[model samples]
Target chain A: MSNLKGWKEIPIGGVIDKPATSRLYKTGEWRVSRPVIDREVCINCMQCWLYCPDMSIEGSIEGKRMKLGEFKMEYCKGCGVCAAVCPVNAIVMKPESEFIDE
Target chain B: MPVKLTVTGAHAVAQAMRQINPDVVAAYPITPQTPVVEYYATFVADGMVDTILVPVESEHSAMSAVVGAAAAGARTMTATAANGLALMIEIVYIAASYRLPIIMPLVNRALSGPLNIHCDHSDAMLARDSGWIQFFTENHQEAYDFTIIATKLAEKENVLLPAMVNLDGFITSHGVESFEMLDDEVVKEFVGTWNPKYSLLDTENPVTFGPVDLFDYYFEHHRQQEEAMNNAYEELPKVFEEFAKISGRKYDFLDLYKTDDADYIMVVMNSTASTAKYVVDELREEGKKVGLIKPQVFTPFPKKEFQKALNGRKGVVILDRAMSFGKEAPLYSLIKSALYEVPSRPKLGSYIYGLGGRNTSPKMIRQAFEDAFNDNLVADEQRYLGLRE
Candidate 1:
């Protein structure tokens, strides 16, 4: 909280200067499990992208085909709605401690 | 040129609203306060003013709609009393937290339990800590004058807080009085146009209002509001000076009547102040050294001015219309806290008077003052004036 500016420095009326600035809080630390997507079994269906509560998942479209983009770890609060909505079992929620950097 | 007119306090407020001609007015009708909106609605219907009058279904919706309009960068106002104000309590806090600068005329009435509707200070006292600036008016003239002044003060760049001008219900709201009213053009010039520093409608410089402020930033935002309130206290005299230049009617945080060489003093608010003045004059003619301190601005508590006026008095009595129930009355407690540090503070007494529009005459006021003078120094019990056993 000390990192945030003092009362005098903040915008009048508590208005955020930039949209989607909640990403500055690093809410990903609250997540117990992280969602990982399997590209091979992924059927270009944007179900997970649509269901992501934090808008942390971006969809990458090549020409007429759409695929999953990189997950934004900064904003993901570990809500598993995206994993529950994936029809093809392409996305899985894995324990954060068990997962090693690839 | 200012002209004299005989009108109810509610109509005087409506007349002020017409002169201001705000961008929006969202209101619901409650007794006493009903005519204020009714008259404004006629102005809107007859093409007298270019204001979007929203005759909202309830006071809650009225306040909510006004909040939205004010946030959208439109000058807005509303009027309500007692139960209507009670229903709007939730949004009242929201409006102040957002610093919307909305002006409201809160017609004072008794908050009901057994359901009685008349004049009292309970309604205004309920919102005392809601972070809105409050002004208590003695008559229709101050009611009209303060409404316009409240608009300018609320919209000041340094002080973007909501404000409420309180006129006693039925006593002043329904009673007609003749008072000088400023010309429309002169009022328009005095209030001027509202230039919001940041607005929700400013697409080019977008801003978010009423955001979820958690532990990290909520305190800081509250501090900002405190700073704004402090700024309002400092900015009020300047605003009063400017208004006086045009209208020749000066005002201050507190109105002092014969406090210079007085040994006994009475402090009160609203229309009761006028009654106290009559008592004070009569006491003076009989060679009694008594004075009166009528607090005009209730919020920000006007601590400094009150301390200066009350220091070195022999005895002081405070009259409160609302009961704090289980504790000291609101105005009495406020005065005690304010004068706590005064070097030779006066012996203070508290009296609860005129609840539910009980008649408070000059004789009753004089008796209270006499009781305060004769009471023992250490006695601190509250006396209920005119309350039958």
Candidate 2:
């Protein structure tokens, strides 16, 4: 919270100076839920990566996504779209409080 | 040499638009404002200016097209009235939020229910909080000048925001008055060309506009928009001064006529101010010190200027062409807030008149002044000038 820029420091007109800077804005701080992946049950079908609106699902880009990958927690907005799209029930939405570090 | 032409307020605005020759004009016509787009489209059709005139389906599309066009780094403009302005107002906020300097000429008319096409300011008042610089013109001449000035002001580096140049519905929009139009070359050079700091077309330095800004940053962006209004209030005079150099018509936040030594000052807006000034003359002939303060710039509200202008007066009467429904009239409420911190404030009275083009005759104006100087004014004396019981 202390590090966030004040009104005077931000650019005028809500115009993001460079495209794709949304990656820099962390949305996980107050997100109510987060997606949890069960690696044992996960089939690397890559549906979550393709369906993620925030593009928070991260994995290898060799066209196969053969192994499970880490979540880009900073950009994830806790929408269950990625979880809902998983072909196997490997990804699930959980209360962010369960994983939040004190 | 200035061209001498007798033209309606709408045509005068079009003549200025033709001179501005903005990159794009997307407009859907409404009465009183129809002639403005009609004339500008003809200019575009005739190759008078290299402008793309997009005849849109509705006022909503009209504003949407201009917003998209302006965002694409094109100098853009549009015109609408009353319900048309109402239709476009949602995108109008977006236009300001993105800080696109689109110039819109608003033909003031009453918002509907008892739908009638005539002069009143309820239309413009609807946009008071929409984050655009607002200029109210008293007649056709001002309609012409402000259209050109708005182009320069809206795109002024410090104030990159949309602006509305307002003319009373049919009274000013359809009123034909001869005004000296600036030579085309002079105006072209005066406004110069738009060199924006950020543009949608600047592919080299790619930028994003109208992003899904959330709480973490939305406040900062909206705060920036809010502060731009202050930047505009400060930059307006310099822009007006520059226009004055080109057109020889000096402008300020308030156009004060015989106000300095008056015991009572009357504040009015749009064409109604002309009537107020005439009554002031009639009263002055018999040695009553009444004067007129017409706000050339209405959106910024010119709070400090109003505080200074109304400080030492014995009394002040505000005439409004629209009502606030639940409050004292619009102009009256603004003047009240402006006077809050003044060291010596005048007694204030509000006289709402001419809603939906009801006639505000000299007789109605006289009644306010006749009562103003009697030293019986309250802090908030709300009265109807010409409404018959």
Best by DockQ: 2
How do the residues A1-102 of candidate 1 rate in per-residue lDDT, one tens digit apiece? 335678888887767756667546656555778888888998878998888988999998899988789888768877889889999998889887775342
DockQ values for all predictions?
A: 0.42, 0.63
Rate residue A33 of model 1 by lDDT.
Answer: 88
Clash pairs detected, candidate 2 = none
TM-score, chain B, each candidate = 0.98, 0.98
Candidate 1 interface RMSD to the true structure: 1.6
DockQ of 2: 0.63
lDDT to native, each model? 0.89, 0.88
TM-score, prediction 1: 0.86
- Residues B44-115, candidate 1: write the lDDT tens digits: 999999999998899999999999999889999999999999999999998998889999999998898768
| Runs in model 2 lying further than 4 Å from the true structure | A33-102
lDDT of 2 by residue, A43-96 (tens): 888889888897787777666445557888888889899889888889889998
* C-alpha RMSD by candidate, in order: 5.5, 4.3
